[model samples]
Target: EDDVIWTVLDRVEISDDYTVIFHWKAPFPYGKAMIAISSLINYPYHIYGKWAEKVDPTVPVEEEPNKSLVASLKEFKPPRPITTGPFIFKTATTSELLLVKNPNYWAADTIENWETWFDGVLCRPHMADYNARLNNIMAGEVDLSFITVPKETVDSILTVPGMRFVAPPTASFFDLDFNYDKYPCNILEFRKALAYAIDRRAVQEVAAYYGFPIDKYATGLPKTFEEEWLSPEFLATLETYEYNPQKAEKILRGIGWSRGPDGNWRDAAGKQIKLAITTWGPYQDWVLAADNISHQLTKFGFPTELRPMPPELFYDAWDRGDFHLRVWYVGFWSTLSPWSGYQSTFGWDLTRPESLSWKGRRGLNPKDAVWAAFLVDRLGRAWKPEEQKLIVEKLAELHNKNVPLIPFVQKREYMFQLDGKRVTGWPDPDDPVWDGVTAQGPQCYTTLLVKGILKPVR
Candidate 1:
């Protein structure tokens, strides 16, 4: 029901077999870009059209038709998965998946340079053990790996003959998010103090070798967009939140917190503060960062612990706001717009003006909830860049003042390995297309494949 597409779309009209027209609820400036970059599944109408035809496209989810549609989809399962892409799924196992080229792809003969050269593609599961994946890449058993190579292993991976590494800029980043509804985290001063106590550079060095420390201002936008989207005057007004243990102590003292005999902080009620950061056990970097942070906070007079849970339990905990703190990703979508960044940071879009509760876990204060809804409405209505920029400045200011989440590292580059021995026509490192190959943008190899550029070397 919270599908982003439903926010802007009023209804869809199929004009012909090849064309579909979208009628938006309003003049949404990001409507086109939103659809283009969205990872929405293309469900086959032939199999589900009967159930879909029962629903009124214009009706809300709570109302009739939508709820029925949802129930119908939940029960309906196709006999076989279908795809209209360049490849069709052939087989799958616990460790691997195989896809063969689609002979009936619509653009095969009609479009220029649309031929698919590779007969099939094999995908290996993301091995939790980094060394195992590294060994496969180095041995040339793997043709291409989407895994990010650890910084310590980059030199060794480069030694492999015909090994090509592509480091594309990432749209996401790692952050330490405070559970706003939780105890000490709920206090603004304590949140600020914790922000000042931790070293972002240290976290980046330990967790994300290819990442850059977030800008000191922490305006909720990546440093890359600050110059383009933020005014010089606005940027100067933001708090640096630099690492200062003394300042953190001062803030704690001011807030009626005192250091006990054991060097742990005691709150105004004489209770010792002990916090825990929950992270996904599978994400080695996040686990390391959480451990490092726990040590730093513990040393700074707060007894902190690292609770690394399995992926399933970790996500459940995150969704239920079951932890004091957590290490997670916070950032924008593929587009260069600040709207998505602010949305991700504040979850402004999650709040409806008519509702008292936010849809997501990050419990926002009442005032901020109202402000978030207002900004979301204003941004949706705003079409011009100049108009959108004005609202973004306000969001940045709010985010800076209220430390909802502390961004530690911005993923500057994502490492993916490509074996040139088996595959030819992969983009050269110096190619201009490499610049556009971001984590969210058109992948270089995938772009090459669709354009009929990649071919078997043998």
Candidate 2:
């Protein structure tokens, strides 16, 4: 054997996940985080290996020489443990998943005392079949389900004897995404114009009112809940996006867009000042939003075209930057940085060369500033309290000004009902903190004491 020999590197356990840190005798950042998200069940992951061939930077899949590959395998199909209270993942299949009681589950002993008042707990996570799931719940086939049933359907479902309802807030939002990579929208005035023409209040009343209208909350974070991690100053800064169609029109008119004989706005070149926006087909709400916005934009001389694409094609066009505007949920998750994961939203990192259309989306090219702040925070570089506050405040202002994405609604008091007999240890719906319990709920983990179901018995 050669004088060089492989040696065990460093190892650290983050929560339950084991992370191996291999410090190669040589320099290579390539394999550092390579196996972070391996499909444990079906795929074998190579810790460190050589490329099969030379990789082409321009190509989607570079051909690397003798490269290591990680593949998902059938034998490793055990459900990975989760941390959402008492809902352990048991047997998972393509169509459905069954969750049995973890005999040694942390909650097992805790809930055994509750069994004196009820039966053992069981949880079944159904796939994306809403109608079938709802029918099962109604026919007494299944005990409970999570569904966004329509208003009329809910009235009928509530009539079922054992059924109860829990309305908790959800982390869903609606907003108009400007294709900054393209022309027209590449101009701030165009975005302001489009923003002016839409009637969000009406749209919320019609589309999002499931039963009630979206509450008027600033900062895009819902007022229905609170998070200590969010700074009060930053939350207070969210008021800049208040709806004002009058100002929207003034901004558009100031940009030299004028009304044409045909009753639409035309640019200086007499070309219609219109944009082609696409939304997912059958999303009646988005379609309605498009229509209302289009109608308003036309008044300001900006003609609008609303194109409905099939769900697949709709997302494809968005990723491709083919549309000028889009109406969808702009997800926001609060992490260490105020602008965590914003690179994909505001930065000009496109998969394809043609998609480099949103190049200048981030208003003042604040990438360097935003990213520097992120690194400083992560690296924990020493700085004065005022210095840190200054950096965070500047980052927040830049983020809001860029408007790479807009916020419409924050998570609200949305709830789901379950039959108590089949599903035990279900978080109480009336609990204010319970609304924030599930991942989808407004709160990280609804205030339920679900330590047992979240972690595996292992």
Candidate 3:
């Protein structure tokens, strides 16, 4: 005998205390039958205790800082049912995080959650030191980690039981970034001299700590299972700048730089044949390479001052084109196709207004510019039959002359360890699709989730 009531009513305000009165067409208790009337009290004002004083709502959200390694993930707006990975984020405090298994997860049956394996997971990202994380992994306190451990540590870790290594292909290139905008290096011959004066192979073997291989020409123009879209000629232009120490000295002498009484070379303007060598932080391998390069350059009467500083300062000086000689790793990649990364590194992007200073600094030469224009013109539009023909031809020419970029080494990817209980899922060691030279991609964490490697702890 339950019936829902529906009604339309109107009320009017009377006083401060009485507030208002309501009137309805139908009355429940006044049907001539003896009944009790129930009335609900109404209040006029809302009770509040000074409503927590507004303390200037945390500064209006701003865009991410420019030219930084760290980036905001907010812009990506990935599709949902979000990531189909194993783990889902539970809670994230400042110091630590908690990861829980998805109750609705599809793989619960095959993986066996609490029945045989762990129940949940916890992770604390950005752990200050890499070695500390590795030590924890070795002591069985941690299950996994994603820190870049040194090769020495990796060698030691390989001998441990219940542990394995996953070596993934990485997009890293270590080379002398010639500041074509600055003096000495402004002269192509001088740039060529510097290139030939140093032994790239030795530098790669020693400086990288065997972390990467000598790529000789670091361009994303080559085709592999993971990526494609480069023409052969675009790769060939770079080969012309191979190592030649004798030719380096000859080029220096031809530039009116002659050996002086002090066993150093002096230019016709009496400017000492010296280079300002800059490095970021204390990269021992690069420091060693710089030292050796300086030693060899001195043989041709040129002395180099090695200036090592933090990356922030180094990048500041580099962007301003204030460096003499510097070393940095370029993660080249393309957005349209992996091959576009090669052109970006060597072509129009190098000379683009955003990449160069407008205050009188010139970047890539016209020869490089021509190749870049072709790339841009091709990619600027959707694939057309005519454009495709032109792209292939232009790329072949660039590759043949090695016109785009002078690549030297390929970087190796390393991960720091974490506790097994804490680390539940990780990406498989494989070539990254958006590797610097392959694609313009997101960060590691995002990539891991996208690739479906980061599973949850059941």
Candidate topping lDDT: 1
Among the numbered candidates, top TM-score falls to 1
Give lDDT tens digits, candidate 3, residues 37-127. Answer: 1121222123211221221233322422321211322243323224344556677776566766666666656653324344445665553
| Candidate 3 deviant stretches above 4 angstroms | 1-127, 130-142, 145-151, 209-212, 215-239, 279-302, 332-336, 346-362, 367-371, 379-406, 416-458
Off by over 4 Å in 2: 1-66, 70-144, 148-159, 170-172, 210-241, 280-311, 334-392, 424-427, 430-458
Q: What is the lDDT of candidate 2?
A: 0.49
CA RMSD (A), model 2: 8.8
What is the full ranking by lDDT, best candidate first?
A: 1, 3, 2
lDDT, candidate 2, 1-458, per-residue tens: 11111211122223534643445433322122222211112222341112222333343432332121212221233347543344445666665666543444455555534433222234444334456666777776655455544456677788876677776655445666777777777676665545445665666654455523333322222333224233676667553545676776677678786667786766667677657777766555566666666665655566668887777888788778787777776333322222223323433323445333345434334454446335333322323555544554544455455555554544233344544444445545676655343333312432232432222111
Q: For every model in order, what is the number of clashing pairs?
A: 0, 36, 39
Task: Give the per-residue lDDT digits (tens) of candidate 1, residues 295-403.
Answer: 9999998888899998899889877878799998765663447766665555455445424543243445778866865786677779888888898888778778877
Give the TM-score of each candidate: 0.90, 0.62, 0.59
Q: Could you tell me how far off, in angstroms, the CA of residue 146 lies in candidate 2 after the best superposition? A: 3.7
Candidate 3 root-mean-square deviation in Å: 18.7
